[model samples]
Target: MTTEIGFVFAVLGITIALFISDKLRMDLVALMVVAVLAVSGIVTPAEAVSGFGNPTVVMIAALFVVGEGLFRTGVAAAAGNWLLKVGGGSEVRLLCFLLPVVALLSAFMSSTGAVALLIPVVLSMARRSGMQPSKLMMPLAFAALIGGMLTLIGTPPNIVVSGALKEAGLEPFGFFEFTPIGAAILLVGAVYLITLGRRLLPARTSEQQTDHCDVPGLMASYGVSGQLHKLVVQPLSPLKHQTVVEAALRSEHRVTLVGIRRSGTLLSSILPVLANTRLEVRDELWVYGQENDIERLCLSHRLTHYGSPAKEISRMGREFGVAEVMLPPGTPLQGQSIKEGAFRQRYGLSVIGLRRRCEPLDTDYRETRMEGGDTLLLAGSWERIRALEGRRDLVLLQTPAELGEIPVHGSRAPLALLVLAAMLVCMTAGWLPALTTVLLAALAMILTGCVSLPEALRSLNATSLILIAGMLPLALAMEKSGALAFVVEHLVSWLGGASPLLLSTGLFLLTSLLSQFISNTATTVLIAPIALTAAQLLGVNPEPLMMTVAIAASTAFATPIASPVNTLVLAPGNYRFSDFARVGIPLQLLALAITLVMTPILFPF
Candidate 1:
C-alpha cells in the first residue's frame, strides 16, 4: 500500500476504535476523521466539507422535517391508536397488528421516531392486557428496523447506498425498489418474532415502573390524591373578588389554588390559575393542601368545601397536565430552592411535589434546596411541559399519557397526508429529483401549518446530519487514495470464484457484524463503496451487492447499543444485554439467509 493509503487506513482504525469504545460522541469522532483527512492532504478542503451539500444529506434532513410534520399533525399517533382499537387485549393479535403498522410508519419516517411514538401506546396495551412489556418491546424494535427496508427513505443506509450508485454515474435505485425484498423479509421476520422469538423474550417486569404512570397513578404516587379539594366561594366570603395572589393562600394558608371554574360555565371552560385570576361568588376553586389547612382556610374565608372533585380533576387534566422532571448532574439549579430560582416564572410550571432518592418530600417543598438527581412533579399546560423536553439543565423523565392524545396540530392531518402523497407520487413519477421533492414536501408541511418552521428546524437531528456529513469525506479519501480499491481487490481474491450467493453471505456477515458496534449509517458510508468497487472488479451488476450492503447495515440487533431503537426499549422492557442476543442473533441470521436468497432474484446480479 502507498503512504497515503496506509495513513488513511490508520485514521479508519482509530475512528472505528472510538466508535466501538463509546467514549466519545460518534459525531465528534466523525469530525476528527474529516479534520485529519483535510490536514493530511488526502482530500481537498472543499471536498472535505462536500458532504454537507450532498443530495443524500439534504434529502435525509428534509425527510426529518416531513416526519416531524406527521408527528405534529397526529398522522403517526393516529395509526398507533388505531392499532390498539384493532388489537385489543390479545398479545398475539397486538403483535400481529403492531409489526406491520410500525413497519409501515418506519418505511416513511425515522425508525427511531416511529418506535418512540408507539412506545407509550404499546405500554398502555400491555397494561390493559396484563402482559409483560418484554413480550412486545423487542418485537416492536425489530419490526421498526425491518421496516426501513421498505422504502429508500426508510433508513440512512438505504439513502447512502443509493447515493453511492449516483456518485458512480449509475442510475439510483427507485423509490420502491426495496419494497419487494423488504416486504418478504418483514413478513418472514414478523412470523419468526411472533412465534419462536416471542418465547425467547423475558417476562420480568420493569424495575422503573414509576417511569410510565398515567395521571391517576402519578397523583397517587406523589401522595397528592387525597389533598385535592373543591371549594365554592360563598357570597359572604372575604376571599370573593380577591385575586389569587392577593388571597395569599400558599403563603398564609399553606394551600395552592390549582384552578378556578366560573359559576355558570361548562366544565371544559375552566380558567387557568394565574396570580391575577380573581375569585368571584359561587366560583368553584380546585385547591390542594393538607386537609386541616384546607378546612381552616374554608372556615376563615367562609367558603363552602365540596370535598375532592375526582371527576372535575379528570376534566382539568384535559387542559393542564403533570410531568416528572429531574435535575441532571451539573444543573445550574443545583444549589437554589425552587422559590429562589423563580421556577414558575422561568418554566411556566409549578413544582407541586418533590422526591429525593425515591421518597416523597414534605408538602412544604418550595424552599427545599435543589440537588442533582432530585425529582420534581410539575403541573402546567401540556405545551409548557413539552417545552422542557430538550433543555440541558432538566431531564424530562415522564410525561402523562394525556400529552400523546393531544396533538399540537391535529386538524392539519389531512393536509400533511396530502403533502406526503404528492412527494411520493412525484418521486415515483421521476418528475423531480428526490432531494427536490423532499424539500418541497417539507416546505409544504410548514406553509400549510402542518408543522411550524421552528418545529421543522428542531426536528432535524443535528448529530445524525453532522455525523453523515463529516464521515462522507473519509469515504472520499479512501477512494481518492486508492485504499478502497486495495481492500476491494484483496476481499475478492480472498473469496476467489465464490458463487454470488456465497459472496453476498460474506458481505452480509461483515456489514451486520460491524453495525452491532458502529452507527449503521457510518458503517454503510464506509462499506457501500467497497461493495460497489468489488462488483465492478468481478464484472457483475452492482445492484444486488449494493442492496446487500444496505440490508445488512440494518441488522443492528443482538445488543442494546446496536441501535437507538433498541436502547429506547431497554429500560421499559426490563431487558438485560443477554435478552437482545437471545432473540436478535437468531433474527439476524434469519435476515441474512432471506436477503441472500431474495436480492439476487429481484436485482439480478
Candidate 2:
C-alpha cells in the first residue's frame, strides 16, 4: 500500500513540478496526468477527465468574453488613463491616483493582466515625467493584486472562495461583499508602497532592463519555435555582400529565406528591406528549428543560432497563446475573471490574447489585462467574432459580423453601474441568485445585440476552460486518498494548538507559497475547503479562516508564477524568473502581516 501511495505521490509530484516548470504545455501535462492516474488505478480515465466540462469552468471562459466587451468600449482604457493622469506628480500623488484606479479596475478585470497593460503605460508616463520605473512597477503590481480582492469575480482567489463557500452550504460571495475591506487593503497597501517601497526597490527602468538583455550587440535575438532559425539580415550584416539567391548557393545547409528584420537604422530613409536582402554570416536568421536541430545543422555545415541563443522562448507571447476581443457596453462581463463567471459555454470563443489602451495608448495588444480599450486577441473565426455587435469602442481584430459595424456606444456605463447596484441589492435583499442575476445580464446583452451571441462565443477562453475541467479529478483524488485530511491533521499538529492569529498567519504564508508554485485558482480550491474543515475542528466560524486563505491565495505578489497576469508581463517586461521575487518578497511579507491582523479583526473568531 505504501509503495502504491509512493507511486501515486511520485506521479502527482512530477505532474505538479512540470506545471511549475512550464516546459511542457500545461494542457498536455494535464492530459498526461489524467492518463497516468487512470492507468495507475488512482481514478478511472473518465473520472480523471470529467473536470474539463464543469459549468463553473465554462462560466469562467464566458466571463472573459464579457471582459472583452468592456475593454473594447474604452471603459477600462479610459479609466486607466484617468488614473495615471490623476497621479501625474510626486510618487505620493501617483499612488494616490494609481492605487484606487488599479483596485477599481481590477475589481472587474484581471489584476495581473491589468497591471501588464498599465505597466508599459505607467512606465512610459513615469519616464516622461522623470519618475523612476522601478518605483512604479512594484507599486503597480501590488495595486493590481489588491484590486483583485475587491470583487468576487475580480480574481481567482475570490471565485475559489465563493466556490468553497457554496460547497460548504454557505452562500457564495456576492459580487462586492468583500469590497469594503478590499478597498481598505488597497488604501493601506498604496500608502505603504508609496511611502516606503520606493526606498528598497531595485531602481531599474523598462528600457534599462528590456530590448537589450545581458547578451547584447547584433540587435535583438528572439526565441525561435524550432531549432531552425529564421533570422533576417540587416544592411549592417556583411550579407549586403551578396543576393539571396547567391547566399543560398554559398551556404552548405539549405537556407530558406522566409522573413526580413527591417533595419532600424535604414528604415528612416528606405522602404522595409524584404526577405530579398543578401545573406551575411551575421545577418539575423529566424531559425525554424531549435536546440538539437541547430546543433546538427551547425555541426554538418556552419551557422550560429544567433548572436546569443536562448534556451527557451521569450515570455511575451510564448508562455501561453493570446487572443483579442472587444467589449460592448451593456455586457455582463465588464467585471470578472473567466473562472469566477465562466465564459466557455456562455460564449463560444476562447481567449488566449489581450491588449489594453491608456495614455500614450497601448493599443492594448497581446496578453494585456482586461482594462477598457483593450483589443483582446481571441482564437476564433469572424463568424464567431462578429457576434459582439454593439460593444462601445472595441473592434474585433478578425472582423466577421459587419466588418464596418460600429458599436452603439450607449451610456451603458450608467447601466453597468445600475446592474452592479442591482446585483448588490439582490444579494443583500435575497431578491435573486447572484449567478442567475449575473447570467441574466449576460443573456440580455446577447439578446439585445449589445453583444452578439457569436461575439460572445469569440471571447470565451479555451485554456481556462480546460484547466478547470481537467484539474478537478486530481483535486478529488487528493480528497479520496485522504491525502488532504492527513496533511491537514499533520499541519494542525505542527501548529500545536496555535491561536487564531497564528493559524491565520500560517495559512496566509502557506497559501502564498503554494500560489507561487501553482495556479492561484488551484491554490484556493485546495486551501478553502481545508480552511473550513480546520475552522470547524477548532470550533470557529469558518468565515475568517476561509477569508485568510482566500486573501493569501490571491496575494501571490512575489513571482510571475504567482499569477497569469504576472506571466504575461514576463516577456514584454524583459523580466527573469527572479525579477518577480525582487519585487514580490517584501510585498508578500507585508501582505501576509496585513492578512493576519485584518482577517480576525474584520470577520472575528
Candidate 3:
C-alpha cells in the first residue's frame, strides 16, 4: 500500500474504534478522520465537509417533519384504523394483513413511526377484542424492520448503501429495484412467520387489563405511608372551591396535601408553596392524613384503592407501593443493569417488575440489561413513581377512558395522506427531485399546524443524524487510506477459492453479525467499502455483492442488542435476554438465508 493510503487506513481504524466503543460521538469521530485526511493531503477540507450538505441529508430532515405531521394530524391513526379493520379476528389473519401493512409503511417511513401508530391501535383493539396487546405489538415492530428493506428511503441503511455504491461510480439503484427481493422477503417471510410465530409468541401487555384502572381503587390499594394518603380531586366538588391548605382546615381534614393529578396530568402540590389558588378539577392530590382520621376520610368519600386497600398504613417505613411507568427508546437505561442505574435510590422504588410493550417483567431484570421497551416493575409510593414518570426515560402511561365526543377531528387526516401521495407521485414522475417533493410536502405540513416546529425538532433523532453524517467521512477515510482494499484482499484470500456466491454469502453473514452488535447503519458504512473492493478483486459484478451487503446489514433481527425492533419487543414481549436467542436466532437465520438466496436471484453478480 502507498504511504498515503497506509496513513489513511490507520486514521480510519481509530475513528471506527472510537465510534463503536462510543468513547466519542460518531460525528465527532468522523470529524477527526476528516481533519486527519485534510492534514495528510488525502482530501481537501472542503471535500471532507461537503458530504454533510448532501441532498440525502436534506431529504431525511424533511421526512422527519412529514412523519411528525402524519402523526400529529392523526393521518397515521386513521390509516391504522382501516388497516386493523381488515385484520379480521384470527391471530394468523391479523399477522398476515397487519405485518405486511406495517412493513410496507416502514419502507418509506420510520420503523418507530410505524410502531408509534400501531401500538395504541393494537392496545385499544386488544382490550376490546379480549386479545393480547403483547401478541400484536412485537409483530408490528418486526414488520417495520422487514418492510424498511423495500425501498432505498425506507431505512437509512438502504440510502447509505446506495450512496456508497454511487461514490464507487456504479449506477445508483432505482427507487424500486430493491422492491422485488425486498417485497418478496417481506411478503413470503411475513407469511412464514405468521404461521410459525403464533405458537412461540406470548400474549402479555405490561398494562393490558380488563378494566381501565379505577383511580380511587388504585390509590387505596397502594397503602398510605407516613400518615400521607395520595388522591386526586373530583372536579367541581367541595374540594374544588378550596386550596390544599384551605381544604384541609376548612373541612377539618387536617391532611398535608403534597401532590395533585388534574385533567390526567400529575403535578406536585406544595400546600405551602402554591396554596393561594383554589382547588381545580382533575388534580392528583397527595395528602398526609392523621393516622386516626385517614380511615374516616376514606369512608366518607367512598374512596377505593389498588394495592391491598385493606392494609392499614401508619408511616413511610411500613409501606411500599406500585406505579406503572413506560420506558422510551435510547434511554441510558436502555441497556444497563438495574443495579447499575441505582434505580432503587434514584426512584425510591424496589426493582420489582416491568411492563414492556405489554409483557410482564422477566425475573432477571435486576441483572438483565434494561432496554427501551420494558416498563419498570416499580414498587414504591405513587408519589415517587409519579414524579419519576416526568423524567425523559419514562412515560406515566395513563390513558383516560370516558372521553366524550372526541372533538370530531377535521380533514387533517385525509389531507395529510393526499399530500404524501402527491409528493410520491411527483417523485415517481421525475417532476421533482425526491428531496424537493418531500421537502415541499414537509413545509406544507408545518404550515398546516399538523406538527409544530418544536415537535419536529424533538422528532429528529440527533444520534441518528450524527451517525449518518459521520459515516460519510469515515467511508472516504477508509478508501483514502487503502485500508479498505487491504481488508477486502485479505478477507477474500482468507476465504480461499470459495465460489463467488459462497463468498458473497459469507460476507453477508459477517456483516450481519457486526450489525447485531452495533447500529446497522454503522455496520454498513464500516464494511460496505470493503465489500465493493472485494467484488472488484473477484472479477464479479458488484451488484450481487452490494445487494448481499444491504440484505445482511438490514437483518438485525436476532438480538435486542442487534436491532431496535427486537429491543422494542423485549419488554412488551416480556422476553428474557436469552429469548432473542430462542425466537430471534431462528428468525435471523431465516432472514439471512432468504436474503442470500434472493439477492443473487434478483440482482445477479
Candidate 4:
C-alpha cells in the first residue's frame, strides 16, 4: 500500500473506533478524519473541505427543512394516525399497516423524520395493546430503511450512487429506476417483519412504561386511599398563625398539605401551598396521609373535619393531568437543576416526582441536577401538558391518550400537501434536478407559513450534513491514492471465474457491512466506484453492480448505531445492541437474496 493509502486507512480505523465507542458524536468523528487527512497530506485543504460544497450535502440539508415542514404542519402525524385507526389494537394488524405506510412516507421525505414523527404514534399503540415498544420500534426503524429503496429521492445513498453514474459519463438512473427493486424489497421486508421477524424481536419494555407515574396511578399503586382530607381551621386553632412548615404537619404528623381552599371567588378558591404559605383562621387545609394521623392532627389543632379531598382533587384532574418528560441525550436541560432551570415557570408544569435510572426518589427533586435519560413526572393544566409537545429541550414521553391528536398548522395541511406533491411531480418528470426541487419545496413551505424560519433552520441537521461533508473526502482520498482501484482489483481477481450472481452478492454483503459502521452515504460513495470497476473488468454493464451497491447501502438495519433512525429509537424502545443483531441479520440476508436475484434480471449481465 502507498503511504497515503496507509494514512487514509489509519484515519478510517480511528473513526470506526470512535463511532462504535459512542464516546464522540459521529459528525465530530468525521470532521476529525478530514482534519487528519488534510494534515497528513493525503488531500489538500481545499479538497478536504470540498465536500461541504458538494451537491449531495446541500440537497440533504434542504430535505431536512422540507421534512420539518411536513412534521410541523402535522402532515406526517396524520399518516401515523391513519395507521392506528386502520390497525386498531392488534400488534399483527399494526405492524402490517405500519411498515408499508412508513415505507411509503420515507420514499418521499427523510426516513429519520418519518421515524421521529411516527414514534409517538407507535408507542401509543404499543401501550394500548400491552405490547412492548421494542417489538414495534425495530419494525418502525427497519421499514424506514426499506422505504429508502422505493424512490430516487428516498435516501442519500441512492442520490450518491446516481451522482456517481452521472459523473462517470454514463446515463444516470431515471427517478423511478429504483422503484421496482425497492418495492420488491419493501414487500419482502414487510412480510419478514410481521411474520417470522416479529417473533425474533425482543419484548423489552420502555422506561416510559415503568417509570412514568401520574398522580392517580401513584395514589393507587401506593395504596394511599382516603389520604386526602380537608380540615377547617377554627379561629382558635393552633395552626391559625403558623406557616405551613412551622405547623409541623409533615414533620410531626406525617401529614402533607396539597393545597389551601379559601372562601369566595374562583381566583382565591384554592391556592397551591408552598413552604412559606401561612395558615389562617377558616383556612381549609387539603392534607394527604394516613387517615388516623390527619384526624389526630386536626383534633390537636382544634380543626373541624370537612368534605372529601380525594373527590375534589379527582375533579381537578378534568382540567389537570400529569405527563412524563424525558431528557434525552443532547438535550439542553442536562446539567441544570429543576429550580435553576426554572422548568416549572418556563413550561408551566410542576415537577412532582422524578425517576433516575428507573429508580423513583422520595426526596425532593427540585435541587437535583438534571441528567440525560432522566424521567420526570410533571403536573399542570392539560393544555400546558399538551403544549410540551412543541418543546425540543425534553421529550414528552407520555400524555393522556385523549390528547394524542396531531397538532395542525391551521388549514395549511392542504397547502403543505400540495407543495409536496408538486415537488414529487417535478422530480419524477425530470422537470428539474432533485436538489432544485427540494430547495424550492423548502422555500415554498416557509413562504406559505407551513414552517417558520426558526423551525426551518432548526430542521437542518448540522450533524448529518457535516458528517456527509466530512466523509466525502475519504472517498476522494481513496480514489486519488489508488486505494479504491487496488481493493476492486483484488475483489475482481478473486471472483473472476465466479458467476455474476456471486459478484453481486459479494458487493451487496460488503456494502451492507460497511454501512453498519460508517455513514451509509459515505459507504455508497466509496463502494459505487469499486463496484463499477469490477463490472468493467468482468465485461458486464455497471448498472446491475451499481444497483446492488445502492440497495445494500440502505440495509443499515443491523446495529443501533447503523442509522440515525435506529439511534433515535434506542432510548425510547429500551433496546440493547443485541436486539438489533438478533432481528437485523436475518433481514439483511433476506435483502441480499432479493437484491442478487432482482438486480441481474433488471439490468442483465
Candidate 5:
C-alpha cells in the first residue's frame, strides 16, 4: 500500500481506539483526526475544512433550529402529553403510546431531544402506574434509536449516507424514503419489547425509588410543602418597601420569603429573597406558609394570591413546578459557580436546592462551583423548565410527577404545528429544495415568535456540528489516498461470490458492531463510501447497500456506550451493562434481519 494509504489506515485505527477508550469526546477525537490528517498531508487544509460548508452540515445545523422551534413552542411536549393521556396506567398501554410517537418525533428532530423530552414522562409513568422504570427506560431509548431510521433527517447517519449518495452523483434518499423499513423495524421492536423484551429487562429498583423520591417525598424531605405559595404585594400593602426580615413576615404573616418575581420582567428576572431584599409594591413573593394562615394573611393584607398552593402543585404545574437537574460529565456548567453563570436569567429557572454526593449543600449554592454529577433542584414556570430540555449542560434527573401534567406554551402550539406542517409539505411534495424548506420553516418559527433567536442559537448542538464537519475530512482522506479503494477491493474479494442478501447482511453486521462502540454518524461517514464501491464491484444498485449501512448504523442498542440515548438511561434505570446486551442484542439481530430482507425489495439490488 502507498504511504498515504498507510497513514490513513493508521489514523483510522487511532480514531477507533480513541472512540473505544472513552477518554475524550467523540467530537474532539474527530478534530484530532483532522489535525493529524492535515499535518501528515493526507488531505489539504482547504479540503479538510470543506466539510464546514457542505450542504449536509448546513442542513443538519438548520434542522436543529427547526427542531428547537418545535420544542421551544411546546410541539414536542404536546406530543408527550398525548402519549401520557393515551398511555393511561398500563405499562403495555404506555408503550403503545410511547414507542410510536417517539419514533415519529425522532424522525424529524434529534433523537436525544426526543428521548430527553420523554424521560421525565416515562419516570412519571413509572411512579403513577407501578411499572419498573427499567422496563420503560430501555424501551424508550431503543425506540428513539430506531426512530432515527425513519426519515432522511432522523439521525446524522441517515444524512451522512444520503450525502454520500449525492456525492456519487445519485439522487439522495427522499424525505420519508426511510419510513417503510424504519416503521417496520419500529413495529417489530415494539412487539419484542412488549412481549419477550419486557421479560428480558430486569426489575431493578429505580434510583428515584431507592433514594426515596417523589413529589411528596421530596417535599417532605426538604421540609417545604404546603408552605410554598405565591403572593403579590399590593401598592398600598403595609409590607411594601420593608426588607423581608423587617416586614416580620415570619411573625405576622407566618410566611418565609423564598423568591420574588418583579412585574414587567421575564421569568428569569426573579430574584431570590434574602434577609435584606426589600419587597416592592408589584413584587410577587414565593413564600412558605400554612394554608389557612396564608389565606387569612393575604385577605387581611390585600395581597394577591399569585401562586398555586403546594397541594395544588399539579394544578399549578402549568404555571410553575420543581425538578432536579444534574450536571452529567462534560456539561459546560462544570467549574462555573451558579451565580457567576447567571443561570437563572439564562435558563429562567431558580436553584431551590443543590446536592453533592447525595447530600444537600448549605442553603447558599450561589458561590459553589458546579461540578459534574452535582444535582440542582430547580423551581420555575413549567414552560421555562420544558425549555431546559435543549440544554446539553444538564441532565434532568428527577422532575416532579406534576411536570408531565403541565402544558407549555399551549397558545403557541398551533402556530408551531403549522410551521412544522409547512416544512413537511414542502419536502414531501418537492415544492422546494429540502434544505431550503427546512431553513424556511426554521425562519418562520423565528419570525412568528415560535422560537426566539437566542433559543434557536442555544439549540444548535456544537458537538454534532463539529463531529460531522470533522469526520467529513476522513471521507476525503480515504478517497484521495486510495485507502477506500484498498478496503473495498479486499471486502469484495472476501464476499464477491456471495448473494446480494448475504453481502447486505455482512454490511449490516459490520456497521452495527462499529456503532455499538462509537458515534454512528462517524461510522456511516467511513463506511458509506465503501458500501457504494462494493455495490459497484458486485454490479448491483448501490442504493440497497448504502441504505443497509444507514439503517444498521442506528442499531446502537446492544451496549450502554453505543449511543447517548442509551447512556442517558443507564443511571436512571439502575441498569447494568448486561441489561443492554440482553435486551439490545435481540433487537439488533431483529433489525438486521429486517434490513437484509427489506432493503433489496425497497431499493432493488
Candidate 6:
C-alpha cells in the first residue's frame, strides 16, 4: 500500500475503534475523520465539506420534515391505533398486525421515529391484554429494521447505497427497487418472530411498564390531590375581567392557576393558563396551592370556592394533559429552581410535581432546585406537552394516551397524505429527481400547514445528518487514496475464484457484524464503495452486491445498542443483553440466508 493508502486505513481504523468504544458521540468521531482527511491532503478542504451539500444529505433532511408532517398530522399514529383495534388482545394476533404495519410505516418514515411513536401504544396494548411487553417489543424493533429494506428512502443505509450508485456514474436504484427483497424479508421475519422468536422473548417486567399514569393516578402519586381546588370568578370580583398577569396570582396570592374553563353558549372550553388569559365572571379556575393560601385568594378576590374539581380534572383530557419529563445529565436547567427558571413562562407548562430517584417529592417542589435525573410532572395543553418531545434539555418520558387520541393538526392529515402520494408518484415515474421530489413534498407540507417551518426544522436529527455529512469525506478519501481498491483486492484474493454468492456472503457478514456496534449509515458509507469495487473486479452485477450490503447493514438485531429502535424498547421490555442475542442472532442469520437466496433471483449476477 502507498503511504496515502496506509494513512487513510489508519483513519478508518480509528473511526471504527471510536464507534465501537461508545465513549464519544458518533458525530464527534465523524468530524474528527473529516479533519484528519483534510489535514492529510487525502481530500481537499472543499471536498471534505462537500458532503453537507450532497444530494443524499439534502434528501434525508427533507425526508425528516416529511415524516414530521405525517407525525404532527397524526398520519402515523392513526395506523398504530388501527393495529390495536384489529389485533385485539391476543399476543399472536397482535404480532401479525403489528409487524407488517410497523414495517410498512418504517418504509416511509424513520425507523426510530416509528418505534418511538408506537412504544406507548404497544405498552398500553400489553397492559390491557395482560401480556408481557418483552413478547412484543423486540418484534416491533426488528420489524422496523426490516421495513427499511422495503424502500429506497426507508433508512439512511438505503439512501447511502443509492447515492453510491449515482456517484459511480450509474443510474441509481429506482424508488421501489428494494421492495421485493425487503417484502420477502419482512414476511419471513414476521413468521419467525411470531413462532420461534416469540417463544424466546423474556417475560420480565420493569418500571417502564408502569411509567405512564392517568390524570388521577398522577395526581395521587404526586400527593397533589388535596392541593387542587376549583373556584368561580364571581361578578364584581377583583380578579374578574383581569388577565392572569394583571391579577398576579402566583406572585401575590401564591397559587398557580392550572387552567380556566369558559362556558360558551354551545360548549365549555378549557383555556391554557397563560399570562395574557383574561379571567371573566363565572369562569371556573383550576388552581393549585396550600389550603390556607387558596382560601386567602378566594376571600380576597370575592371568588366562590367549589372544593376540588376532580371531574373537571378528569375531563381535562380534551384540551389539557400531563406529561412526565426528566432532566438528563448535564441539563442547562440544573442548579435553577423552577421559579428561578420561570418554568411556566418559558415552557408554557406548569411544574406541578417533582420526583427524584423515582420517589415523589412531597415538599414545595416549585422551590426545589432542578437537578439532573429529576423527573417533573408538567401540566398544560397537549400541544405544549407535545412540543417538549423535541427539547434537548429535558427527556419527555410519558404523555397520557389522550395526547395521541387528539392530533395537534388532525385537520391537515389529508393534505399531508396528498403531498406524500404525489411525491412518491413523481419519483416512481422519474418525473423529477428523488431529491427534487422530496424537497417539493416537504415544502408542500409546510405550506399546507401540515407542519410549520420551525417544526420541520426541529424534526431534523442533526447528529445523524452531521454524521453522514462528516463521514462522506472519509469515503471519498478512501476512494481517492486507493484505499478502497486495496481493501477490495484483498477481499477478492481471500475468496479467489469463488462464486459471486460466496463474495456476497462475505460482504453481508462483515457489514452485519460492524453494524451491531456502529451507526448503520456510517457502516454502509464505508462498505458500499468496497462492494461496488469488488463487483466491478469480478465482472458481476453491482446491483445485487449493493442490495446485499444494504440489507446486511440493517441486520442490527443482535444487541440493544445495535440501533436506536432496539435501545428504545430495552427498559420497557425489561430485556437483558442476552434476551436480544437469544432472538436477534437467529433473526440476523435468517435475514442473511434469505438475502443470499433472493438477491440473485431478483437481480441476477
Give the per-residue lDDT of model 2 (tens digit) for 1-605: 35555666676678667765667656566677777777777677778877665555544444454444443333443444455567655677877777777677677755644563355356445533556566676677678888888888778788788788887898677787777667777777776787766665655555434432221111111222232243444434444567544444213333323233343222111001322355554444443333554455554435444623443222111111212455555445555543332332333344433334512222211223354444443322233345554544445433321122123333454444344345345533546654455466556555544455676786554543454455566665765665555655666777637776777877787788767655677667777876787777778878888887877877777765455555434433434445567667877777777776677787889
Q: List the residue pairs that clash in candidate 4.
A: none
TM-score of each: 0.60, 0.48, 0.49, 0.60, 0.59, 0.58
lDDT per residue as tens, model 3, 1-605: 77876776566556545644645544466566656666767767776775567665556567667766775665554554465567765667767778877787778765654554455455544543456766776667667887878888777778777888899888877788878878777776676567775556665654425335422323343333344455545533566667544554313544334444456544432323445657676554545445555556555543332222232232221123345566677777777776567554466554444455555543343357777867654444444544664576576654222111011123476667777777666754668766777779888877766667887787664444444454465455556566556755666678636677888877877777766655677678877777787777777778887877887777776655465455444443545444444555566677777777878787777
Candidate 2 positional error at 11, Å: 4.0
TM-score of 6: 0.58
Which model is ahead, 1 or 4, in terms of lDDT? 1
Model 6 ranges off by over 4 Å: 87-95, 102-184, 191-218, 224-268, 271-316, 322-406, 499-504, 510-586, 595-605
Which structure is stronger by lDDT: 2 or 5? 5
Q: Candidate 4: TM-score?
A: 0.60
Clashing pairs in 6: none
- TM-score, predicted candidate 5 vs. hidden true structure: 0.59
Stretch of 10 with least lDDT, candidate 5: 264-273
Q: Model 3 — which ten-residue stretch has the worst lDDT?
A: 399-408
Task: Output the TM-score of candidate 2.
Answer: 0.48
Each prediction's RMSD to truth: 8.9, 19.8, 14.2, 11.0, 10.9, 10.2
- Each model's backbone clash number: 0, 73, 31, 0, 2, 0
Model 4 stretches astray by more than 4 angstroms: 22-28, 45-77, 106-138, 148-183, 195-320, 323-381, 384-432, 439-470, 513-550, 559-582, 597-605
Cα error, residue 526 of model 6, in Å, equals 11
lDDT of 1 by residue, 1-605 (tens): 89999998898778766765667776677788778877898899889888788776687677778877887887765665567668875778889999998899889766865675566567646654557888999999999999999999899999999999999999999989999888988999999999999999988776434346776677777877677788999999999889877887876887876667785452332123366677789988877788999899989999999998766765566567789999888888888876666666678777778788988878564557988999988876777887898887789888875675556998899998899788767765658866788889889999999889998898776665676678678767877898766865676677646767777887888788767754788778888987877787778898998999999999988876567677667666877667888899999998888898889888888
Off by over 4 Å in 2: 1-8, 87-98, 101-184, 191-431, 497-504, 511-585, 596-605
**Superposition error at 210 for model 2 (Å):** 14
- Per residue, candidate 5 scores C-alpha lDDT tens digits across 1-605 of 99899988788778767765667776788788778777878789888887788776677667667766666665665555566568766778888888887888778766765665566556656755567899889999999999999988888898898899999999999988999999999999999998899999999877766654556656554545555777889988888888765776654555545456676442332333245567788887776566887888888878998667543444344466667788898777788876665555577666656678888664433457888998877766666767787577688776665554443345677888898777766665667876787778778878988778997897676765676677777767877898766765666678767877888887888788867755688678878977887788778999999899999999999876577677657655877656788899999999988888888888997
Score residue 200 of candidate 5 by CA lDDT.
96
lDDT (0 to 1) per candidate: 0.79, 0.55, 0.60, 0.74, 0.75, 0.79
